[model samples]
Target: MSGAARAEHRVLIIDDHVLFAESLELALSLEGYDVRRLELPEEGGSMATIRSLALRRNPRTVLLDLDLGRFGDGMNLIAPLAKAGINVVVLTASEEIGRWGGCMRLGARRVLPKSGALQQALATVRRLHQGLPVMSPDELETLLDAWARERRNHDEVRQRLDRLTPRERQVLGSLIEGRTVRMISEDSVVSEATVRTQVKSILNKLEVSSQLAAVGLAHQVGWQQGV
Candidate 1:
């Protein structure tokens, strides 16, 4: 390829998987793209490095890995990269479809599962370079809607959780751990009546009619104490 073609095909990969990154770099380079993968530090902060690079030599497209090891979060880098007028094509091994929605909402041009073949990835890059859309507008809109719904559900869960006192949170945690009300009361050295009152409060605060429902919600949303 000519120097001008390589210059126009500049691409950056911010992935920690050394072997994969090197393979992608070689593949892209072979296809005439001037690809470079960020050399991650031992501890992380890949977003900082990406921001620094964007200021110096921003590429036309970025093939980002969702998990960056200690190189900080790749998810957090999407908005800023897109805001910089760079097209972002997320490459992730995650099976979570909701996460792909988050990526699209965060301004990713495309979210591709890493399970795909290298030829598919190469084809995606070629399409982008030729000024083509990787996915349809309808597909993009659907993912964006999914993310919005997920965000709403998250905020609602958080708000309900925030209403709990520390004791209530502890009780909720115990419930999640499969402790019975009587057992919890015995462990805390409290009366059975007091434990029942706390259980009622927990149900009220969580807005769930049953203890099982509350526990299910906690696990589903990946609830953690102190949020």
Candidate 2:
């Protein structure tokens, strides 16, 4: 069953490291899977690219790198890929264990450190494709605990975001886009002083001290326009 499954499985690698992606593609191909590679997409377009590729290739699994250098975090692609019915196995250089929790909650099937052996990574992908659990009992428990904590943090962040009034939310959207007080004021036909006051209110409601901090917090909770 495993051998036949391996022959039919398609794996897509989305990593910005050209050399590493090439090597992984070769390795997977040698292991009897149809493998494809794609560098990270430009900012704000990764989700669409992943959806389109998944629709075209219909890969059974995706090996994703969380860090895409200048492109941005590959974590953003997990949910969309999963929704497209592709199993995602995270291949990351990130040492922070907390990030693993986030990835798993976002629909990744497994997380493999880039420091691990290539053979082990390949085996994990195979297991996932065969509908097997990748984590041991202990690891599953740890992941559940970490996921619970992350959920709590996410809820708190959402609560803070809910404190903003409609106009303040608009100000925040402008702020995240790198718009200055004057620019936002002129564009919205509001006074500069009014923009400043709204900015202060946004900061206070978001529980951040400054505009930069507010922007950072907004990103942490996956805040975007109309969301």
Candidate 3:
């Protein structure tokens, strides 16, 4: 048989719940899907690992959990995978209106809460295979609204960055590129102390905590385009 003929519909599930992953794997297996489960750690899973696994299975769809274990937030992985051309469906129990809306805008085909029935999730898979949009009508509307609002936010972030001095923007650019403070300082002809201060100010102005968060936010806002 050819690859698609011999292969069952492949599925890559990213979740920290071990028993749940096994259960899901077994369930999908019964449905003739080749399922691979990655149980994320308590501190969250690695994007590199998830991406590598996806490339390996090349699943037609992904079942992603918004909460990995304890501190693992799904926000970091959702947009990245979606941007990479993977079809992702967020499987989470979080019903927060904003989060649900945000996930859809970030390229999730569907967002199914764990509290819902397993049959619903399986139904979603069927819809995906049938080339039908997976999310519910309500969810679709929410996603569209969120996408529009997100565009506005991007414009706002751009305006904010435009107000920054050229040096500050340069520092932000280097930071987004994953350069260290020392490296940015050396490359930008600024002292390490000044680089540190600039980074601090940038974070404060952006209202983000870490460099990764800032980088992600910047990417979402189109500030770090072409990266």
Best by TM-score: 1
Q: Each candidate: what lDDT?
A: 0.84, 0.83, 0.73
Number of colliding residue pairs in model 3: 0
- The RMSD of every model to the true structure, in order and in angstroms, is 3.4, 5.2, 8.9
Off by over 4 Å in 3: 1-7, 39-45, 136-138, 144-227
lDDT value, residue 72 of candidate 1: 55
Tens digits of per-residue lDDT, candidate 3, 116-145, equal: 637777787767766787756876997678
Compute the lDDT of residue 92 as modeled in candidate 1. 91
lDDT of 1 by residue, 29-105 (tens): 88888888876666544577766865466788988898977665689889988998889899999877778899988
- Alpha carbon lDDT at 143, candidate 3: 66
RMSD of 3: 8.9
- Judged by whole-model lDDT over C-alpha atoms, candidate 3 comes out at 0.73
Arrange candidates by TM-score, descending: 1, 2, 3
Clash counts per candidate, in order, are 1, 0, 0
TM-score of 3: 0.57
Pitting candidate 2 against candidate 3, the one with the higher lDDT is 2
Give candidate 1 regions above 4 Å deviation.
1-7, 44-46, 173-216, 219-223
Over all chains combined, what TM-score does candidate 2 have?
Answer: 0.63
Candidates arranged by lDDT, highest first: 1, 2, 3
